[model samples]
Target: MGVNISKGFLLVLVGLFAYLSLLLVLPFSQYVLGAILIAYVLYPLQQRLEERVAPPIAAFALVGLAVAGFVVPLVVIVAAIASDARRLLEQVNTDSIQLGELERAIEEQTGQTVDLPSALADAAQNVGTMVLESSTEWFSAITHTLIGLGLAIFLLYYLLKDGSDLLTWMRELTPLPDDVQDDFYQELDEVMWAVLAGHVMIAIIQGTLAGLGLLATGVPNAAFWTAIMIILSLIPLIGSFMVWGPAVIYLFLIEEPLLAVALFVYSMIVVGLSDDYLRPILVDRYAELNPAVIILGVLGGVYAFGVMGLFYGPVVLGALIAVLDVMNDHYDRLADEPGMR
Candidate 1:
């Protein structure tokens, strides 16, 4: 009893230290997890390269190539998009682009005056105040984001080279039987690729399609909204509709009925159907889960894990379900044992 008590006390102290250690890493946990996901996907390529080149050299080369090829281009695109969005916002704030035309058209149809310009002025003022209040917060956020990106890239290099050893350690540490642990890891791999690559590619495709449609239909700042739509498309069922839906309504209000009609049809048939047809193909069997799981996972993930939470949430939930199934199997085995009865 005394030994048991001592052991319990030791465990409690260890747990306390462990939790504190986790808190230290929490600020950058998203990057660590993101690195894991990217490294896993790139591991195959890394392995292929390792056969000819040295392992460390191959991993370093892969990371460098990815940063040069993928990350650099992405940053450039994002900066360009941000500049376009800023220009649009400036136009809106300065009244260079007036909603008054749309407002007058609405009032004409409904026979009720809507003073949208005044409201926009008020909105702009409120936004200005909000920006002033949040500037420091935004600075901190930007700093953290840059740090996270750097950490992710650095970690990816090592994970690509040494992840197999890590996997071995994880298996040994896991409490479950070897087979159950293997199964869980397999599921994790499959679901992760499905969630990340499947969702990201689909979102980019749909967002680009939506953006092109918007540009073709004469929507201002199509690039700005396109970036937003790509992020929103990570959500199941919502996809590009969030942008295109508002766009159609805006087009109608501006008295471009033909443009509105075209936008609506294109959104429904092209953007909407693309997700329906392609998601299952991309996600394979992982896409067959209840809709609520996806919604909750995504919402919870964003709240918990920032952007990467989008993939992390659904995958975590899937893992929990896998654990539950394993426990249920253990219970079933116990029930089958006559000695326990």
Candidate 2:
């Protein structure tokens, strides 16, 4: 008994040491986590491609296509934006045409002086500073992009090449029974699929609708605004609102009441439907998680992990809930056994 106790104590110590070591290596851990997620997202496509060809080459080509699909457009957009950004900034700063109608309309509406010249000066100064700061940041980003991309590509390639074997090895390492392991993986898969399907679909729909609305209403920089809306739409609750609110206010200030109303109506219909209705439906269909669990997971994940937390947070929460559910099932079964009480 004493020897057994000593061995158990040593095991506990080793586990604690490993946990602390992981904490110490969290930056690398985050990258690994990100790679795992990317691999998981792309695995189905890889498998489909493998069905048609050799596994190794299929994996490489699939990852390459995925990388190109993401990187090429991103590079092109960034390059174009970088090239045009300075000219745009100069235009914004140098152009000083007064919005006489806007000022008069604002004064009429609010009984305020509406100091147009002072505001324009302030706006130009802000714009100029923003332009300078953004250019510097973009240059820094460009320097880092190659290094990051190389690392992501390497990790993705290895993950795609050996992911199945790695998963099998991990499954073997788990001390849990096979049933428990299966349950955990099942829950994890459901959560990931739900998040991927719900978030991506909703973002695309919202972005498309926003772009269409902007184009229909003759808004300048519609594509930029639409892109911004799509990115913002990843956040829960107040995503698209952030993009459309200022736009509507600007339209109102410019006395484009009809355009403002149309934009508002269209945004309400499309954005609202996608986020409020469609997303939840997909999540529910896939995850079967309690609403409270979903909300807490999202809020907690965001609080702890920033943007990526949205994907990882709910998954962790779902796994926890799944574990508890399994425990409850066993407990209830044991309680129902004859003479158990």
Candidate 3:
């Protein structure tokens, strides 16, 4: 009786500590998860580098490359976009642009009065103001930003350098048989590749192609619209249409019907067809995710983890599917065993 009581008390203690530990880590969950994902993506590079250099040196080289190649360009692009948006708002507010012309055109077409200029001005102002405020707020929180960034860097380095040992440790801790664990790892590898290479790479290509179309059609602020298209392209069932669609309407409103028709045709033929053609070469060759899974994952992930959640959401869903598959196999094996029957 006493031994049983001690065991119960011990289990309670473990549970309490586990919950507390989770609470402590919850605030920095984004940084931790971001580091893990980035490390996983860069691991191949790390391996190649380590073949010629030490592990720590390889890890450092990769981190430095990421800072220069990814982080720096991202910061510059965002700053430029924000500046352009502000300028656009100013241009929209100016009387010389004849915003009334578009409103008149719309009213003439639909036989209904619409304050399109005021609505557009209000939207531009809000977007510009929001972006400027966000930039200011981010700069103001320098301490917190630095801390999160430093944590990501530190974690990233260790993961890149010691990922194999970490995998071994996890394998030891997992209670599953070796073959089941191997299957889980294999499924996970394919899914991650699908998310990164399949979804992300395809989005980039599609967005760039749409951007070129925008440029060819002589759309105003093509760079900014291109950036927006790239982001919208990340969402399943919604692609570059959100930006080009408005541009088409605007072109028609401005009496550029020829340009508008050209854009519409180009978008349908080039932009729309790209997915059908490229998806098989990129994603279908590896693993395919159901569109529903990706959609739900993206929505729920963004709600939970902000921008980073986009990648993490689908990954979580993929991991869940893998677990379910493994469980199904386990139960099948159990049913096949004859001792109980």
Q: Pick the candidate with the highest TM-score.
A: 3
Which lDDT values do the candidates have, in the order given? 0.81, 0.74, 0.85
Q: Pull out the clashing pairs in model 2.
A: none
lDDT, candidate 1, 1-341, per-residue tens: 99999999999999999999999889898888888877877898998998899889999988887778777757866886787778777667555556778888989899998888788899999999999999999999999989988998989988988977888888777655666566666766666666665666788888989988998998877777888899888787777788899999999999999999999999889887887788777767553445577678888999988888888887788677766766675656645653331
Give the Å error, residue 63, model 1.
Answer: 1.9
| Full ranking by lDDT | 3, 1, 2
Q: Model 3 over residues 110-208: C-alpha lDDT tens digits? A: 998988768889999999999997997778678666788789899999999998899999988876667778888988888898888777777788888
Per-model TM-score, in order, reads 0.76, 0.72, 0.78
Highest lDDT among the candidates is held by which one?
Answer: 3
Write model 2 residue lDDT over 285-306, tens digit each, in one string.
7875555665577678878876
Model 3 weakest lDDT span, ten residues long: 332-341
The residue-level lDDT of candidate 1 at 249 comes to 96
The C-alpha local distance difference test score for the whole of candidate 2 amounts to: 0.74
Candidate 3 runs further than 4 Å off = 1-10, 82-142, 332-341
